[model samples]
Target chain A: MFLNMKTAVAAIALSAMAGSAFARDLVINFDDLNPGPKKGFDDAVALFQKENPDINVIVNINDREAHKTAIRNFLTAEAPDVTSWYPGNRMAPFVDAGLFQPVDDVWEENGFNDDLAAIKPTMSRDGKIWGVPYSYYQWGIYYRKDIFDLLELEEPQTWDELLAACGKMKENGVTPFTIGTKFLWTAAGVFDYLNLRTNGYDVHNALTAGEIKYTDPRIRATFSNWETLINECGFVDNHASMSWQDAIAPFANGDAAMYVMGNFSVDGYKNAGLTEEQIDFMPFPTIDASIPGAEEAPADAFFIPTNAKNVEDAKKFLAFVARPDVQTQWNKTIGQLPINSKADISDDKFIQEGFALLNGASGLAQFFDRDAPAEMAKAGMEGFQEFMLDPSKVDAILERLDTVQAEVYK
Target chain B: MTHAAVPDTTASARPSWVKRNKLAIAPWIFLIPALIFFAIYVVIPIFQSLWLSLYEWNGLYSADGESTATWVGFQNYAKLWDDPNFWTSLRNNLAWLILFMLAVPLGLFIALFLNQTVPGMRFYKSMFFFPFVISQVVVGLIFGWFYNPDFGVVGTLWKAVFCEETTNILGNVTFTCSRPAPDILSSPEWATYGIIAAGLWPQIAYCMILYLTGLNNVAADQIEAARLDGAKGWKMLWYVVVPQLKPATFIAIVVTVIGALRSFDMIAIMTQGGPFGSTNVLSHYMYEVAISEYGERYGYGSSVATVLFGIMLIFISYFLWQMYQDEKGGR
Candidate 1:
């Protein structure tokens, strides 16, 4: 009797597997569970399913942090048809491991070569494009427009004017900047802007790429500028204990006037009860003026795993996501910039300002963490946080970073 | 042929060798299932981790079904010797071990205090046990908010005592303090202690309950005799009650040591080994190096795990030896 039941169960399972195999399924693993990002992704997937009626789409959405660790397992174990991931050095390890399949043909056929030209260099490794970027957003200083207006301060174009404004704000009992270095990456945002402004994009790239030492004179110059900012235009007190969202409290309450942050924080600002009229965005002030500015804009992309079962459907989905209309709709809902140049942007003030800033940049960096190798980025960001907490430890922090860089790059 | 059949029937009727050894074989039959599972899950992974520690792997596999791990012999271990973060994690672990011992005595005192059969004693005991009932993650989060310098209890109290709330230029209410409240979780010197305090809250409750159960088994006649002989307070409790509570104390110390070694969740929830990795214990550091978003160094993490396992093995063997000696003495 047990053997008969077991045979019956095996037959049922086999038929169920056969049923799924014949249906032509496409599996997509997305990493954002936030309301805006999730809604945007769901809407895009829904539209794709509608357009490709024959193919059944199975979507799995995971928390961003959970997805980071899960991708390492799923990409190799049970490869998804398409998966959300970052571009640049963040994708290097998977690319090197032969886990991510190159999608240059998708880009070529979809005309993303010209439309997504800005992110082409970052997405390419070993002279082949590895993924398709759907959306990216700019990183800069988001400040309190009302506070700036009340203090009679214009957007500071240079470092000296920024310090002067900071002094005025401090005199008026307002902190010049607010940041939470608890997670360690917020410090990197500040560091990237400083280094980019101090020595320009090439030096920033060289430093992250391990070609230049952290104790090099040029890098030291950036640290010195950071020290000046620490001494003159101090960040909010006890920032080391707060997350980026927590730091928004001081900004919303007018305890602090400026935040060196990304465009995506607009949602957080709104959630914290700040209106559009109250908050504003500006590019980081120039430090040397000799070196041209390069803005930080990290892109989120999708790749087909090497072992993906539904490669055809995955490529179609990638091309579909890259289309101007799809990207426009997706980024608009998510409050980010579409990678397709032809995609129309919303009338959002921050989006307009970010668009102009990126348009005028000498180059676009993928942020410190995304640009540097993971180990190097981790060590470097920790060093940045240590330096931020205690400016006097600049030499020691830099030396430690030099040691980590040596080990990481080797 | 009839005589041979008769002799065979007589032999079959008698008990066989299998029946004779059934007493010895029954326990082995029952134990085999659990023994197989233990070998597969526990015994195998410990050795696998030890083997993986000698390689330099990023925890990735190639397109083909082959591991991409490269053998680097003792390079990962050699790297740990030079790494400052490893040293910090070791120091924090040592601190956890030393500080966590306080729970035993504190728990004993609380157990003694609550041992009396007074009215509403059960209510008090249950209340004392509340921390243990609540999850460690919740404790970490509660303490994290409590120590916050901006909107937490510390921040609010600091503002009340040292500062006045005033409207800023933008008509937003903000505080101007003589000095800022201490940021405990952000400060390297204080963050570990803050987490340890959170850890101790639940741990003390656990040890208290262990002692409470032990206290119930104490002989009333012996206590009365000790009281008649003027053996009271600390001396009576130390001389009479403690000697009898040795079993409970052993288990408490064992659990506490194991707890100290596995202090990962509190640190993960509270600091993530940050304000620059100052609060990392060995387990959390291992997780950080192997599993975190920026960490894929499986070999390095395994090496650290192996070192942690070695420490745990020593403690476990010592505990086993003590238990063996105790059994011998009892016999």
Candidate 2:
């Protein structure tokens, strides 16, 4: 009886040793709890679990807006192993505070430098890559195809052509653009596209970095072009009261024909009962022929917090997310473009069009709000809305923006 | 018995203290819990915000895990002086305070009308009080839809009156109005008034209920006596009914003033201080600066809060003094 008990005890000890070898737990805090993004995130987590069966994954999803505030509290106190955040200056403050871990090792191991070259500059600060970008989408003008066809108008390629098209549309009793600046960021999309088209990528960067003033002649030129757009290409009436979703009403009803928006708005248009044939994407018209074509493409990425308990697992998850196949599947599910250059894009027309537009661009800007500091972006977007409402306030708006820029950067 | 009797001396001594100070100490003993909660939740935070106003913090931590607060004495106040948004918010706040007072007279008028006996009168009174039961967020949303320029009631009315069906370059059916319809929530000049109107819907209901209760307690004999003395209609209401309803009027004014100052949630839900920050009040402006998605300028926000607090202090102190005098006279 003693010999049998000893053998049973030995067997239990051996199994416990085996269990200890693979004991690993990873926690991920994702921001978007919306249906599409949530499903995509769950699928990714499920796939990760299937690959590493022994590792346990804890996924905590939060509403996107609430996450914005909760992140400040969570990052300092009880950080997850990995958390989703934006790239560029949005991550700069956290990176500077050493809350986010530098994932250069993961990038090097996964050969992300070549694949994510387009977004590398945004993800890097102080010579270190802070996060792994999974998906990004291009911003452009989504216009009514039926309107263009009826007017016998081809897509405008230059500033003058766009203006002429706007004039013609106006004569036909259709507003050229529909924007809801109630949330303030929609106005910034217009400002970013104009600035990127008028000044090259360098000037745009310099302005957002606060190396140049808003009153600079280059920025003023951008605003002047914006003034022309506001005057010639009139937006929907009472736009400041409508949300981005609410603005879709006028567009869907054909009261407005064009919108300066992102690829995500395609789904919104579709959900608003607009058909696939009714909508088409075009790059923002060029203002200066000498300036190269650069586009605004905001990226969503995941980062490891410095206080993460499972650093190795977080790095592994990031590397897995960087895989071309994983990125392709994730972006396809969410209807956005994968950051991986080698990733396969679906044949959806808008996605195909956005891919081509971003690939051919000289550089990618992360939109005005993402590229600029949060404080500066807020004031800047408000100024843009003010300018859109009353073009005559351009000088005063620029002066105010300059003052805010000085204060923010200092 | 000798071994068990230990603390009877202390127990006996405690009864003398209790007997001598029971009147003075009993009320305080009953009040300690409430006073503790009041100090913790209310009194402490006011001073905390005041202290926080002198420092610049991003609501984040430094690399060393310390709070990222840098002392900047009156710089935030100095900045507030130059901020155009501040002046706009202050002006809107004043407008709200003045306009929201209309609820008092309107509520009293409704209360007087509903004071009469009629069939299903309880239902009517409850219906009139319905706006008070619904939350401000819901009211803002309902009003938001009511003011929508697309499918809203006002929009539909305007369309029927002025719009003509037209096909555009898009080859789709659309309506072109003779003139742009009034979109109160979107217009900078009109947004504050629109929100104030929505707010007053509930405020009026609240004041109405207050007056309704006061009307229930009115001396019918005295009212009849005034009527016998030839008081009628406006004179009867002004001299007899209104004079008797002074308590209700005072309470209504006090609550209306407080509601006007605490007009943050309505503005937050409705326009978010939008239409170029023209709808901002001090509270919403403070939130926009300190805690909103923009960025945490804690010092700047706290300074705004400090200014708001300073303004409220003047009225509150006067209110407290009045209450103190009333209490002394009653005693």
Candidate 3:
């Protein structure tokens, strides 16, 4: 009787194992837990699960900062089927370590070759596409429309025009631009625009790639223009003490007229009690006018880890995220522009403005921090903050950056 | 035939070796679990970190479970020597160590004041210890806002003295100061001191509680004897009370030294070693170089940790030696 009971237990356990094998588990790790992004991700997952009902989808959402550090450990120790990460040099280390698997086949099969063409170059490394981009947003000058109207200033189109506007605003007892460099990246946004405008896209790429020294004449020219902006435009005082969110106060209160920021800051302005009518977006004004304008648009993407248990389902999810209809619904909920060119955009004024700005741009940079290696980026941003605080120290700051660049890229 | 009887004879002879050495073996038996734990968690990591400091790694591993670290002996240390930021961090650490010592004397004073038998002495004691009960992160955030130059306590005070509020062109009220208010956290010169002041708040409370317990143990007869011999106030404190409070003072100093060395949380919450990395101590700098969003230099970060360990080693060894001497004297 005891022997018969043991056999019965073994049969039941084998059947249970077989039952779970039929409905495969696909685990996805997401970074952002903010309301809008979370909703977008949840909606996309729901749609995927509805179509692939045989697969059991398990989603783990983490705080973005925590996810960044956790990705290194989890990718190796307990790999997820799909994980959210960034594109470009930011993802280079993981790709080099053979932790992230190439999804070139996914891209080819889905015709992302054409739909996600804008971010194709960034997503590809080592002659293979590493991930699929879902959404990206443009970086430009976000200004207070009411403040501009009160000052009777038209959007500046040229370097001289911008300087003249700055002078007029300063004379009216208003700071022309407000920035907080406490976290350091905000200053890099300003630097990327200035460099891209002064020396063009190729120079920006070369500088970040460490192919050119920071003390090179072209880069020095960029610094000269930045110095000119600081001396004349005069960003809000004590900017070094404020975070990007804290800097919004001066702009909202009309003490400052403009901000060099990304599209994501719209929600921040709204939360600070400013209405849509009070604000407007403008492409960073032309500095040289000879160089075609290159705008900053950092993309967020998803990749399959090498140790993933369900490669088939992870690829399915990546392709689903790249679909035009799926991307349209996702980016719409998140207030961002979809990676799929065929995706429909929101009718919101700022979204429309951003879409138009990116559509007409000659090139798109993945921002200073994203384009550059992490070590170089940290030192470079600190130098930019220092220069902003004391423009007279430009020479010393550039020299210091040259030393770091040599050490980092080595 | 004799071998069969030998086993029974040895078992009964001399209580066996283990039974004879019971006093020596029993303590080790009790300590085996803790020693194993300490070896795994504490002792192993120190040597591992030291070994790791000689390599170049980005804190990643290959899919095959091999470390992605490359051996680059002493290169990281040589680089640290040439790096200006390292010097700045070291200087800031020195400043923290010196300023943090003030907590000991200040704590003693507060403990003395609270030790008197007033009407609501227990309530007053709890209130004095309240800062210690709260988390360090909260203290950091409170001080971060307190030092803000726009709407914080310092800013409001500055505005009241030097500025007038007026409506701007877009009809929003703002200040127009004759001279701008001080931005302490933004200025590289002052930011470190601002954070240190915040760290000292809770640390002082901690030291105060330690001394309060010590004060409870102070013999009333000894104090009376000192008083009858013309000892009072500073004389009483220095001659009679302080010698009795040696144990508390030693612990307070040790904790304060460690607290100064690990001054990461306040700087992280307050400025994140910002305004051009002026306020970094070694601990925060090591973390920034290893684990922060931009930092992945594990080998380099380990070298920084090694240097920090070296500094801490000096204090730790001195403390241990002092304890050893006290134990010997007691015997």
- The candidate maximizing TM-score is 1
Ranked by lDDT from best down, the candidates are 3, 1, 2
Judging by lDDT, tell me the better candidate of 2 and 3.
3
Can you write out model 2's per-residue Cα lDDT over B47-151, one digit (the tens) per residue?
989999999888888534788788998888999999899999999989999999999999999999999999999999999999999999999999988987777
**Cα TM-score of candidate 2:** 0.94
DockQ of each: 0.68, 0.59, 0.76
Which lDDT tens digits does candidate 1 get at residues B1-331?
Answer: 9988987997878768888789999999999999999999999998999999999889988776578899999999999999999999999999999999989999999999998889999999999999999999999999999998878898889999998989987887888889879999999999999999999999999999999999989888998999999999899999999998999999999999999999998999999999899999999999999988888999999999999999999999999999999999999
* Worst 10 contiguous positions by lDDT, candidate 1 chain B: B59-68
Fnat values, one per model, are 0.79, 0.66, 0.84
Candidate lDDT values, in order: 0.91, 0.89, 0.92
Q: Write the per-residue lDDT of candidate 3 for residues A1-410, one digit (tens) a residue.
A: 35324433543344354454337878888899899998999789877766776677777888799899899999999999999999989999999999999999998998899888878889989899999999999999999888888888999988898899999998888899999999999999999999999999989989998999999999999999999999989899999989999999999888998899999999999998899999999988998878988889999999999999999999999999999999999999999999798999999988898998888877889999999999999999999999998999988999999999999888
Measured by DockQ, the strongest candidate is 3
- lDDT of model 2 at residue B244? 87
Q: Please provide TM-scores computed only on chain A for all of the candidate models, following their numbering.
A: 0.93, 0.94, 0.94
Q: How would you encode candidate 2's per-residue C-alpha lDDT over A127-230 as one tens digit per residue?
A: 99999988999999999998888778899999999999999999888898999988999999999999999998999999999999999999999999988888
Model 3, B1-331: lDDT tens per residue?
8989998888888487888999999999999999999999999999999999999999999988889999999999999999889999999999999999999999999999999998999999999899889999999999999999998999999999999988777777888999999999999889999999999999999999999999999999999998889999898999899999999999999999999999999999999998788999999999999989899999999999999999999999999999999999999
Determine the C-alpha RMSD for candidate 1 after optimal superposition of all C-alphas.
4.7
DockQ ranking of the models: 3, 1, 2
